[model samples]
Target: MNKKKLPLKVLKALEPFVGMQGELFTIEHPGNNLLLVKDKDPNSKFYYTIEKHQIRDGKDIYSVIFAPKNDKEVGAYSTTIGADDITTTFNSWVLFLENYSKVKSFFDDPILESYQAEFFSNFEFVDEHAETNPFQTAEILQLDYLLEHVSTRLIELSDENNREANEVIVAEIAFIRESLTNRSQKWVVEQISNIYAKIAKQGVPFIKEFWAEGKKELIKIGIKALIESAQNLIS
Candidate 1:
């Protein structure tokens, strides 16, 4: 198999994480762009692949798949990133790398290994059996948009020194980061609802000024749509 070269930008972004002990390889095939990180332990490996294809709108779609080496029979988790060009593609990969590093750390720490294994198994099961495309749903797409908008506004609020709101926003950011790996619809609904409820308690005026009235309603609609969609999937 011919080894594919990763873009210079991606290689640079991954440089800090590359230690003296492991091997990094990239491969480009007709269907996918691949990056494989093989740890010192031969049994352990990390796979990151991106496949570009066209959607109904004639827009390019980049789908990312990340799978950690596990002894169990588990499939990889996948997600889509909205990217129109190479720069945006690189930025999306960098964002993914940030979360991938956190998940990778779980395997490196002895104390977290068990929990990591459990997470992998659960993730595999969900990936194998999920009937609906989590990303394709109108509700999920809306929720993703709302969360991103809120995240940006929260950063602005934080910069202004709203410490309490910043704290909550930080936690929400962490939750959103973790969800990228798990991709659980019910979990996404719960986390979004949790943040919405907490912010709601701070008063409508505060929410309006910070997150905006239109965005707030969009979140509410997104959450309700997700909850109902999940229920329909169950029945």
Candidate 2:
């Protein structure tokens, strides 16, 4: 069984901006910058670390954290950026938080409540454990049926307009489907994480591959169903 590592594309996108100094600049790949947006308590968590510095001008200087964990110990490395103006740093941070928040909210779909419930039901914790394993609680086998349904619907909807974004979305869905069918647990988690990371880093181009053929009747049905569900939920 092969395990899926994190998306190299996303990590590549993050590299240039990871510890860069800028003025009036935007950090495009803000999704992986988890420290600013996520909750800090033990119950909820996000990865990464932050170090603040007092610059010569008394402004806040920041660094990026790099860490990978194993069963035995937690280790970390930090990279410091050159310098950023006050306004650019603040704006960039806010934009990063907003983007990550949106990605997080999408995973909170009403459809996932039951899957999450099932996940936590069998979730285990060791009181003496020092390192946290984020991947252990997942049970994507439960997601297969729902994911296929959503994928088919999304593919149909994309057929209607043949839009690039919809196409890529369809490919992602297929990737998830194939992973599920093969019972590739690590691949499933990696794909989901990549989806969020893509949305955070590159936005919707994450789904451009599937929309190439242009609108189909199935897609129209899917689009209608999706809209109807949205309306009913809102109502």
Candidate 3:
């Protein structure tokens, strides 16, 4: 196994900036500059890695690799330069993350498909461990149902005039749903607060009333901590 690794200096420099994207993606670094953002579809799961360096000619070069399971499968590589300033680096990566999540598919291009065919000549697609998607937790079944109602209402309330806020609201709902599997009361509450803040206008009352009606079901069958989190979202 030829594992591609990044230098310790690069990893340390990238830590704080990389962490900012955590809330928006299922990120896994595993002690390197390589960042893995899990796709919702298991069969089409992919990763994006960015490496920053200033090793030659006193210029910063950002090298990006978009692939499946890093070097374990085929990849697309692009190198860019002069993104040395911190602000530039931050903006570049944030844009990359947003673009990646929106486009969601790179190998659809014939060029990228050719690259994959080349790599798979000797490489096998990594059999990444299967995970239960949509993240079901028995104890949070009622809370999950409540979140579904909330998500549906959010879509109904979505406005093209407030596209970015609508996007944030949608993403926050996803964070809230994924948090249910962790069984972490604190994390779920944090996500709830996040979603509530973004949707306070037009979105809050709907959630509040929904919670009012939904809490009865929660009280009957849901986890206590989740019940409290529901209260926190409205209060």
Q: lDDT: which candidate is best?
A: 3
lDDT per residue (tens digit) for residues 1-235 in model 2: 1113434432343344454432212222233342232222112233344443335465434565533222233354466553443334444444543444456554454433343333223322232221222212233433544456545655565544455755675577676666454422333443443343332233344233222221232233343332342233223
Please, what are the lDDT tens digits per residue for candidate 3 over residues 31-80? Answer: 44444444332234454556545566764565654543222333554555
RMSD of 2: 16.6
Candidate 1 accuracy as TM-score: 0.32
lDDT agreement of model 2 with the native: 0.38
Give lDDT per model, in order.
0.45, 0.38, 0.50
lDDT of 1 by residue, 145-199 (tens): 6667666666666645466766766576566654543444434433454454445
Q: How many clashes does the backbone of model 3 have? A: 0
lDDT of 2 at 26: 20
Strongest candidate by TM-score: 3
Score residue 159 of candidate 2 by CA lDDT: 40
List runs of model 1 lying over 4 Å from the truth.
1-141, 159-161, 177-181, 209-235
